[model samples]
Target chain A: MSDSDFSILGGPPSERNDESSGGNRTARDDRDTDADPTPELPPGDAATALHRARLYSLLALGLERPDGNGGLEMDDTTALVNAAAALDRTVEDAATAVDDHLTDTAERKKRWASLFGVEEGHTVSPYELTYLPGPLLTTVRQLADIRGFYHAFGIDVGEKMPYRGDHVCYQLEFLAHLCLRDARLRRAGDDEGVTIVVDARRTFLEAHLGRWFWRFAGEISAHDDGFFAAVADLLAALVEDEIAILDLDPEWVPDTSEVTEWNEGIFGAAGRSCGGCGADATGLEDLEGSPGNPRNPGSQTAQDGLDDR
Target chain B: MPQVHNWQLNREVEFPYEESRPERQWAAMFDLNKCIECQTCTLACKTTWTHEEGQEHMFWNNVETKPYGAHPIGWDKRTLEDMGTMEWDGDTYEGDTIFETEDVDWDDPENHPTEERINEDVAGFMPDIEDDWRYPNLGEDETAGEEMDLDVHFDEDTHPIWFFYLPRICNHCTYAGCAGGCPVQAIYKRPEDGVVLIDREECQAQMVCNETCPYKKAQYNPAETISQKCVGCYPKTEDGRAPQCFETCLGKIRLHGYINTPEEADDSDPMAEPTNPLDFLVHQKEVALPLYPQFGLEPNVYYIPPTTAPVDYLEQLFGPGVEDAFETYRAIGDGEEPALEGLLNLMGSTEWSITAFEVDDGEAVGYYEGDEVGRVPITEPQTERDRVDEVDGEEVYRLDIT
Candidate 1:
């Protein structure tokens, strides 16, 4: 195993030695419970792709709304630093800066809420639609396009995520998934699979994440200068590196945020209400004891045995 | 020509492909009596499936006021005009279908859609993307027949003025016209569920499908350089859930299920064993009729003809079943058909596709793949509140009481 790989997966300095001294279950489990014993790392380009993909996931996790006592985990921070060091010196410095400014979970949680949560009116919008130009109804096609990319690969946002398909975290995670798929395909010696996944990653970065991420980073830097600012700096650096590595020249979003809010009134009265009255037919459920409604008597008796039936 | 039986037309019709029915066909029925012209179904389908740039003109599910409204202006009028005069003899339609309007010999390999002859021989006109699709609501809420009079009170049997909302989606036809008209043969029907699809990789953008699809549903996506239409929400249907439009209907007008031919229709009492609700509504009771069945596609989506519409006008739209359908529907209101009434109540009650349904003890129970997912009372109970109530030693008047 490479020294950088050992650093990226940060465990006790003894975990590296444990590899040579048979397997250390405790240390490996602490990092990844599903870690394969003495796993062989993909060589060269594939290894770099895997590391980059992991960093993308780490960045996505860093940007999500943290729970009351949840912030960037210690191992993730360590991995971010070590992973950045292997990829770029500037990103490594940004990662070191993030480590230097690391605060307690509660403090970072507050910062996240202030920056991206609904409570503060989302001071720095983490949604891609907020960065795109044109009215929301018109520009929503971009959101659909992003979702289309995910769907093309048979990826869907799970119920647990519950985020809009265009949320930055989902976009980032999508890119990470593509890159990870590319690395696995490469390792399996499936040239065709590698080509397909790599092309998808390049296209996604060019179309979505590549266009607006810098604006997102700028918004973070303008609003805060502590842990989040450093993380944003790292995000910008990593994305820049990915662009250069992929040899891409993506069209950047306009510097000014022309955020479009979907106003109900502008579209007219019809848009005012939807998903209305989960009931059908003028609130028939509220109507009691009518002629054709013979089920009223049966309903009273049936309610008791609902579970038994 | 390969002649396939279209029960809707009560005749055999010409089709490009041989007769091959899927193991099961996806079907839906809409109760027109309850529709209020609300476009919730349109938006639901829009937000879910066709929100992209090229899809601006596309409404995979659209509602239009009958007689005067159409998504692509005059879509029905133009197709019907092109087909010339069509008349029904009892139940049999004596008119050329869209496939037969141009008199192309389907049996001849030279006249096949794959032979690049669709431009010359196919029926229906290709709609202008800019002009036709621009006015989805051109005739929305506009009534046909006589103008409104403040004191217009007609008898129970007849009304001078009437209009009803007609919600439309791809019928996912048994012999899809789009599949028949594709020059590259890119369009196909799935053998499992009869969901129609245009293979994007195989589509050469011949655009014949757009011209020949009489319903104007096989729309060309200029951005993708391909023809696109509703895929029947096969992904959801495969998992036994209703399509988005059917699930999101505010009026509970839609019931999604599967249907079989009259001979194969399941007549087993739903209370005794699983029975297809669509078969019961379509084949047994015959309360529902297909939209434009004379088009010869045998569209799977059926409708309960609007009770208030003029019988002659409705006969033109839903074929000769208008009067009979209305009679059967009226029987539900009279409490004569409790099972059917219960099934109507159970429509849109859940997101699951109801494969089987039963009226058990005055309650309508819907089942998906034999697992009960919906149950509703055939008759809803009512309560009347007193006009005056004492609250905290003060008399309170109830303005709204039921």
Candidate 2:
């Protein structure tokens, strides 16, 4: 909405307007899609307060992992020791080997190369968001929106990175880095600067990143897999928590049932993006989950279907 | 090879101070059978906690119908595939529990703190930066390009058939995904309560956790540099009242309290009678019933099997077979990190825990098993008229819309 919003989005002024329009579309769609944005709310005032109560209630229902093994092969403590040892070998000591591919690229090398195209060599990994799908590029635009919101609240992503990338996480990291950066300068006696930066941390998180976060995550979750949904869920919880810390009344953290109804009617739940799904997506036909069905012997998942029956 | 976040994966692993105290022990339970899909829990949560800025993506609490549940629809397909175990439901897909990974950049950077600390284990750029939630799952801007049609995204089977509201927030796991996923060790579990949170000063928003979490609970905050996340409203609960969602719940379905133990293990009490439903859900491993327990992150959230979710859903998503596969995987020992099975069991097979609801008094019921926790009771049995009334009007329980 402002000139700064364009800059934070990673583009020139002219491209900014186009992107802003597009971004607005994204926001609008988030509110207008098949998702029941207007989810019914509880019958009470201080609805947000009720929301806060439920959040803590759910957080309490936690689970545990087998120290390292289901312990079938070893006992719980033994599994923990073994797991710790394995972590020393494979993870803690290893370099970024994850359960899934480190990067989504079909060809890690090619992907890495594109990302590390800089003449100075690869500062950024090629497998990073630089290699993701085009739509993913919009992450930059969202970043800009976030930046703009921060700016509106007088918070800057600060100087964590030389340049903001399209990656949303990276951009947020930039903000976190700024927090530490400011803290260091402050400890070095840059008290004034530190104060400004710390203040930015609170405002930026509550105002920009916290607002419309569910809408953003919903977009990712609607079409993506558990990874996206999980990501959305985590983000939703995190932002809400932060908003509470900041003492900012985030509308998304609905307390009243009316607000929930309103929210569902506007954005759908589970961070599920309804912005782009076609209108009237009301039947199994609308959701072609059949192909991904384990029942569909023709699908890749068929062979792995277990005999739960 | 373990994809260790250059920033984190090694901070002086501080034992949560409060968890050591017996009073800090906390837990939860869910009554799937009692749930009518009213979504009051979800709505109450949103309005009370998530309705504000930057939190549009979060649902600290939500209730959905069984089978083809969730907004994204088919959540189980990927869980099954990721876990390497799922059952077919003829033309439809069924639930299949999967394992999740705990890594850096798991949540959105703005949601938690990244490791920008001067020296706490992170070694790059003078400090490590990290985030809590990962993935840009929020709104769009002009820059995201054109609407890439949902068709272009992935499959429609993303939705399952037998829906049940799996209202979720943070599990506050013994081993939190948000805390473990921090590349810079910016996130940490509160010493007193074991609630995982982002250290504002330490977070630099590197996004390592964003990509590392198996559950994808972490997310990205676009242009922000730091990550953020849920804090359990410790400030509020410190007084022992209740969480925001719990307070706002019109149905009074939710309860709030503390968990006293650091480990969610059996504590030599497989059939130990805990105090509340929270205790039941918190000690899931004690019951040998897990919700994608294969993640190995040691989550703290738990759910009872949904009595009405349909047995077929359980078989297809996570039956004993998948559980066996996961158990076997756990048996593989720790030497091999193995690939992350998003929904698979420890043995890299299907694993799931359904939401089960039962009642003690006419109104108070048990939400889950393994622990002596109580949940809200269902007033009436399932009936077409009842369902119609629920759909046409709001009720105490969450009845399926269909």
Candidate 3:
């Protein structure tokens, strides 16, 4: 590997020298003593972050509709394959899937439209609001918040491009921007810029992308078994790796009761009773008219017992 | 109920209620001959409004290729098919309006078709995204008629296959079918400028408006559970500015102004006293014709039909007056008619409302907010430059001081 590539993957030269010299002070370490307070990341950490950023950029470009010519350039595909391979050996399978599945520009465009475009039965929607459980109107508020984030960073959607603020490709592209910015700041010794970029990345990942991406990926994989499915797999892997790197707790907590309630609400509350066998639980009649009472009657043992009585 | 004159239907139609007309009726005309389908208007409108979630597929200003293009994929064909063929006797059109075509019991809200029924009956199909239609540009740029052979030369007598860009928005009809079809009265036409709007809070998402609108301008926002459409940028228009689409047309093919209604104009010929540029073109010159006037909505938006398109097809779409309108347009293009020069010069006159206009010398001067914002020349000024020549691989350039 070249010196720059080695430094990007392994950390700065001083840190590597310190490690190789068995914790002894090296000539380069003398100069880096003042810079040590900022705490340079290990070479492995830097390499991982760079690799993740590259993967994100690749995915973002891959998902975007090709410029003018229709499909992605061979160079872009090759770079994506290389980046995925660097991340994990298993990613080679996904790279192969992309090559095998998405061949020509026209086929790619058609597949993209079918999967993400507003088609008759689009397999997947790229918007975050679709996956979130809420009234459809409330999605506007979420969109505004996403736009606010973009605006804060001086990034505005092009007037000509009609795309939602929370599109998956856009979100991924934003993350890539943040990572690249952080990398530049690190290299330039701009500690403040680095900190700001890193913090923004973590906050964005935690609040927005990390919230529904796993579920979105699962949905994509379930619906599509082509290049997008492979993309989904890669996305899930990247998000998980990011979460670990950021030292963030697992974001999604699968609530069976919440899911059950949601399903019941949608499909109808038949073959089920309200509330467990507890005296405090609101009765069916009480819930029917009482505005202050909880809408959902958790569990059904109490109603079942009352029926027996 | 108020009786309104629908010139296209050549009869008086009943409105929901009689209300005093706005001081000025907002109107616009687009020249299809100059439109290049750049989509500048579409983007301008999108970025200004409808950038929110649930509005992802909405294109209030869309330019679709005629003959094979439609935002909602056959919006015109389906509505025309349902209404059946229309009859034309010279300049008069005999056809059923949206109100006359199908029986929609507006009084009984519950009996009205549900979203599913409306989708099936009115739209005749469903999009993949539930309650949301896609393919705004489906079959865009696709030409109708037989493919030309590579070696074939053009024949002067025979018409060639062609397509025209049709930039569309809310017509803001005097008698909006969307407003009339809304069971809950969620849709309404403003008494001020005759702009149509949907009240989101009151909308029950019955989607009857979507189904009933012949133009299919009313869109169902599934997330919002309401039908929304082009509000005609009333907020901007009220402030003496034009709609986003009108303000940003790159082709300079749009003209915005207020036209005197038949009831308001003192003269029997409304064109006799043309206070604004729109009045001059739509009334005096009669170059621009309303699209599908037979629908009887009395749509405010007008169009200058493409000269290259078949005359019969153009007549079928715009009425028999289309031939006259085309003749006037051709005369204006050839600079043979000075009477229509001011109207042609007013195309893309100003970004704001043109309250007054006058033709001076060869330029059409438009007054907006009591200030002259535009002076469109009847003939654009051209500058000639001498070409540089190379002699024996040496560049020879000619320089002109004046």
Candidate that scores best on TM-score: 1
Q: List residue ranges in candidate 2 displaced over 4 A.
A: A1-308, B1-25, B71-80, B83-161, B223-225, B250-252, B260-289, B310-312, B315-402
Model 1 misses residue A181 by how many Å? 14
Residue-level lDDT of model 2, residues B1-402, one tens digit each, is 112111011111221111122224343444343355565655655555444434444555645333333323333343334444333343222322111211222123332333342212211111111111111111111111123555554323222223455555565665554554454555555444566555555666665544344444444443344555555655555544355555554443344544433244333221222233333333333222334443344455544454333343444433333333334334324423111111111110101111222333333332223432333322334545444334457654536643
Candidate 2 docking quality: incorrect, acceptable, medium or high:
incorrect
Residue A226, candidate 2: Cα error in Å is: 62
Which lDDT values do the candidates have, in the order given?
0.77, 0.36, 0.64
Tell me the spans in candidate 1 whose CA falls farther than 4 Å from its real position: A1-88, A95-123, A132-211, A220-231, A242-309, B16-18, B103-116, B153-161, B392-399
A178-253: candidate 1 lDDT, tens digit per residue: 8788778888987767777777787888988899999999999999999899989999998898888788889998
Clash pairs (backbone) in predicted model 1: A288-B381, A288-B382, A289-B381, A289-B382, A293-B379, A294-B379, A295-B379
Model 1 docking tier (incorrect/acceptable/medium/high)? incorrect
| Weakest 10 consecutive residues of candidate 3 chain A by summed lDDT | A1-10
Q: Which ten residues in a row have the lowest lDDT in candidate 1 chain A?
A: A1-10
- The DockQ of each candidate is 0.04, 0.02, 0.01
- Model 1 Cα displacement at B125 (Å)? 1.2
| Ranking of all predicted structures according to DockQ, beginning with the best and ending with the worst | 1, 2, 3
Fnat, one value per model: 0.01, 0.02, 0.00
